[model samples]
Target: MNCLIIDDEPLAIDIIAAHCAHHSDIKVIDTCCMAMEAFQALHQYEIDLIFLDINMPVVSGLNFLKSLKEPPAVILTTAYPDYALEGYELNVVDYLLKPISLERFNMAIDKVRQRLALPKPAVADTASVRNLSAAQSGPVKNFIFIKSNGKLVKLDFSDIHYIEGMKDYLKIYTHDKVHVIHQTMKNMEEQLPESLFRRVHKSYIIALNAIKQIDGNCIETEKGGVPLSSTYRDALLKTIEK
Candidate 1:
């Protein structure tokens, strides 16, 4: 996807755009300090995404996004909370705070792209569905190869006690080590099979076999403790109800 960055600060522009640069799927074609410069680029080019900053000179960034006729997928990059409500009211993809980590940026960017490129629901054939279920019943190997920093660590599913969602990453807590990966809680949940892990919160997923105990909103596992949401509490109760 082609992206355009509209930020007033040079450093802020570099931080956000540099991360986008590393991802091969994204190409940041232009960087503008003001709305007018961006307008010229938009006139002659097609932009799929915009990383917009809320605080800028003369014309504010939020105002600029609102004034567009047909805006691209926008991500509000700012250091303030005062404008978040209004930004969401305008239907922004994701709101990111300042001092942004590369991991957080990657998560937010993937989310917006996912939102923009929502796939059509597959029309299922009864034959195909049946085949899938028959195949899915087998005990699939539950493992994840995580590339953290510069090392690839293969984690066995049984060894993972639980996982915690950080600002832009997940801390996969296993018996031996905690491996961090640049991924959303939502993405990780999809990769992990139900027979192995369950979402206990908006921010946590745990291996059922590895759970040591449950206390209120928290789960005690071999690695450490993590929190669960009230909504998922009933589900947990069902497991231990017997």
Candidate 2:
């Protein structure tokens, strides 16, 4: 993936570029010392991700990001943690507090790759649309492709034990491995088949067959106990009875 690093500090730019060099998949297309130079770079190249500093002279990074109607995946790098919430609010892929460690930098890039890999929603034009019959379509799919460690990994529905939500990411628990994915809980709920999975809490989704017991406000699974919210308790019970 092509990357653009934007920072006022020469050292900061060099540090990020050095880190980018470690990843074979990441190509450092250009580094800009200011927002205007960064703007020119954006027009000149096809950048997949941007390493941006939150605090810069004249125009702040967040303000620069606001100007773009559609931006490539952004990872905010800053000395201050105050703008972290604001950065995530702007839909940045990840927030890295400087001085950024190589491990942390790798984590951020993984998120960027995943965000770039996510399928874009199709825009249909009725004038040029083609119709397909039901008989021509294939059978139902029982697996889903999730971005894990910068690659799309196919996972079967039956292997999912449960899912736990972080602020802007999800921990998908399978029988043996836990996959971290950049996605919202609402989007995951919509994508998962309702018959196999159920949201037991705002932060938890348990596979119906994976539930060993529903003890009080907790749902037990082989992995661990998940909190059951009152809002979804009735619905879970109703589904189980059916």
Candidate 3:
């Protein structure tokens, strides 16, 4: 994989480059200290992977990933374990905490290689699109079965207002109830329809029919007004305007 390291620490970058050199398949294309530098490199080069750091001066790793229209597979390298769960929620390939060992690094790279080996799925995700459209096309009995805290909860599609993303869990907001599930927002996003649900933030997704109001940097869904993320502000506006 042709990779780039977006980290402020020079030593960290050097170490990562050294470790990656041991593997013939992984190549360090360039090293950047900030998002802009990486952004420029992205335009200049055909990079396949990004070794991003969570804690940076201005734009963090997560925020950068959120900004991309087509993000490459990322492997987060950070000192903070607390953000590991959150990183996974973004569907990053791997999370390697600081003081990375060769074995651990190898394991993470192997996982990425395995994913790269998988066959590419077809573009026809239309069957799912039609089902979701049918739900709102008319008064259809639309619902989804979700695994909550300890049991399976069947929630009507219209009952949900939006979802809140916690580290490794999600808070689902129904008409009069909020249920927390030990699953990532990305997992829930895959099951929910894009027509009814839109990911308005890195940490939020809202049902189009349940929004009461939309304020700058926030949303007033049926559950309550939740803060909107700057990372997804533009995307949400585009989706809601239509």
Candidate 4:
């Protein structure tokens, strides 16, 4: 999908462009620093999606969108939370706040993809429903963003070895280094994809593919060993068997 970025701030434009560079499906065709420039770009290229900043000089993003006869899918970017309601009223695909995380940006892109692929209003059939279900489960995201040390850290599922839970904080063991973040084991477990991670113990969650061996109640990863509780061992075994 071709994307156009419209933001007055150069840093904001750079951030969005950097995030767009990560997605193989999105191609950023043009970037505009002003609403007028964006209007010109719209006429020049076939834009499928837009990353629009809400507060800008002259015409606001919402006003510019309203002026367009048929605006493309827009994901509003803003520092203020006050514009959220107004942005939604314009039927934007998603709303992203300033200093957007890669994970959140990817989610917004996914929403744009889903919206663009939607069929017109019609009676749903069994086959169509099945196809929709398949589309919704198209592919699992390969990475996640973890907030640690006052910044968002992106980690690929493959790079994670295991996670050890401490009181009020969790330690994530990865290929290169360990990240200590203020998070609960349950919350971390919920965030990770079940296909890649498993809750082996109340205090541990290990990447399924990272498990080198399982000896009795201990699961060994490349980094270190994690205790596998009897409560979750059977479920882990079931998954491995499948």
Sort order, lDDT high to low = 4, 2, 3, 1
| TM per prediction | 0.49, 0.49, 0.48, 0.50
Model 3, span 68-164: residue lDDT tens: 8888889999978988888888989999986566568778888887877833223335564444334323444366666566465778888888889
Task: Name model 4 segments beyond 4 Å from true.
Answer: 118-242
lDDT of 4: 0.81
**RMSD per prediction, one decimal?**
12.2, 14.2, 17.4, 8.8
The lDDT for every candidate, in the order shown, is 0.75, 0.79, 0.76, 0.81
In Å, residue 51's CA in model 2 sits off its true spot by 0.4
Model 1 poorest 10 in a row by lDDT: 129-138
Show where candidate 3 strays beyond 4 Å. 118-242
Query: With candidate 3 superimposed using the best TM-score fit, by how many Å does residue 18's alpha carbon deviate from the native?
Result: 0.6
Give the alpha carbon lDDT tens digit for every residue of 121-208 in model 1: 3444645533443343344555666658856566778788888998668898888778887656754664566767888888888889
Clashes of each: 0, 0, 0, 0
Clashes of 1: 0
